[model samples]
Target: MSMRLQGRKAVVTGAASGIGAAVAARLAADGAQVFTADIQGEVDFVADLTGTDANTRLVAKANARMGGLDIVVPCAGISTFHPLEGHDDAYFQRVLDVNLIAVFRLVREAAAHLKAHGAGRIVTIGSTTSTYGDEGLCAYSASKHAVLGLTKSIAAELGPFGVTATCVQPGAIDTPMTAPAFDQMPEYRTFWEGKAPLRRLGKPEDIADVVAFLCSEDARFVSGHGLWVDGGAMVRH
Candidate 1:
């Protein structure tokens, strides 16, 4: 069996479902000691990441559970598909709080342990929306863009300490988070399919496989890269 991440410890935020859950499980399958945190009850740890103390405590627990931390993947975020004109201050702050600020705090807490290990990995969940914006999702696109920026900033800051950071940008993964839109507009699903040269919506596994590669030893030389796992959506057929 391939033990790419053997003996390493990983903490994944938003692990209760979707891409986060898939990443956590894949990492575990590859022999990393996985600590999956989410706001909901079903994950390994339940904590709202936006709260200062909660974010800290979750990281502390993860470090304790796995003996040490080597990898951190922040996957927590939200989306509201309203046009820019309809977006209000409160909505904007909420999106930023969960998608951007929480990731900052998670890294802040997890970095020390990762640095101690040297050759640490920090992977953030970004999106193709940051590259190609949809009309009704200005806020989401902005948040994802910031996430890519954050990933780069941290990569630059932590590289000297042997910690490398990268962002994975996914497109149209079939998850509960997208269930509402899929149900509301069948045409929307068709749009995603037609737009993708692969002629299919992304599965969580599709994104998870790339993430697993990023965290592996083979990726030690890569940093500050935004790897897109979008089923050829970013390209023309």
Candidate 2:
């Protein structure tokens, strides 16, 4: 509405639905030309982020489409429910590949372009589990925890170049990714709702709004921080 991001170019992953979709739409609405990537639905680029060359190709395509890059939002992720005793190496690896490793690769591929732009922004989507543990989300939690570390590391390396890196941690968002959890544990919905001070579930736009701020000029001095968009869920935790 403010056109705060006018002339800015952004690439948002997992943009077909949920928080990613909301974020992409918000950035575009804010006057940034957005190039989106996803394995499904209509998007500018379609590729699995876990693929070996997917990150490279995605960044190349975004740069080509937008002529340059100023913002990067790595919002792709996956989660599975399994106790620690049942946690297998394959499951752990798969979660990390999509949630953590892919993020690193995406940022690595886009780092130079972002640096060149100056005031470049990298906003990663982490989770409430990033700061704490979840009942059946060992691998997901670990990957999210590592996301904070990755963002902070990137901030350290990119801050001098006028590029900022930050993470937004959401709690119990209503999205396709959490649909399975809601189905398997129906009570989870009510439980999360009660845990939040807002006494309601979080919408994709709830997280997207914070992301918009972190990517805007208003947050120029913010970096290496994980902003919680959890509707006070973290406070209860």
Candidate 3:
């Protein structure tokens, strides 16, 4: 509806479904040309970002497909439950690979193009657990915290280049990434629903709306921050 992002070129990962899909759609609706990648499904490019060359290749492909990169949103993430005891190193590393390293490599690859453009936006995804630890989400929480830190550093370094970096921390979003946990522990759904003053689980589009504003000139002066799109759960919790 609003052509706020007209002529902007962007890259979005994990765009086949869930939050990534919502973000890509929102950016497109705002008039940005979006190139999307996912591990599976029908997207512009299929990339397993956890692999060594995939992240770099995805960035190059997106840049080529879109013409120039002005926005970067890395939304691909995975989480599996395991309490501290006997949580294998391999499992923890996998979470880090998907959630943290993927973003890092992609952002690193996109940095030059964004800086060249002189008005770039980088919106990374974080989680409510970014600031604290959850029982079985140790790896997820750690990776998210590190993502927040990485976004902060990016903002500080890129602000002078007219680039903005921010993180969106969503709380208890009802997405495919979260469905397994909520399904296995139905109580989580009830608790999160009751915790928020809004009394609802988040929708992917809710976070997407904020991301659109951040990518647009409306939020030109906002950067280096983490926004909680949690339906007010953080305040209530």
How large is the C-alpha RMSD of every model relative to the true structure?
1.3, 0.8, 0.9
Q: Candidate 3 has what TM-score?
A: 0.98
Misplaced by over 4 Å in model 2 are none
Mind giving the per-residue lDDT tens digits that candidate 1 earns over 26-112? 998998999989999588889888897877998889877888999999988888578788689889888888999999999999889
Give the runs in model 3 whose Cα sits over 4 Å from its true position: none
lDDT of 2 by residue, 37-152 (tens): 99888999988899999999999988987799999999999987989997899999999999999999999999999999989999999988889988889999999999999999
Alpha-carbon TM-score of each model against the true structure: 0.97, 0.98, 0.98
Residue 232 displacement (Å), model 3: 0.7
Q: RMSD, model 1, all Cα superposed?
A: 1.3
lDDT of each: 0.89, 0.93, 0.93
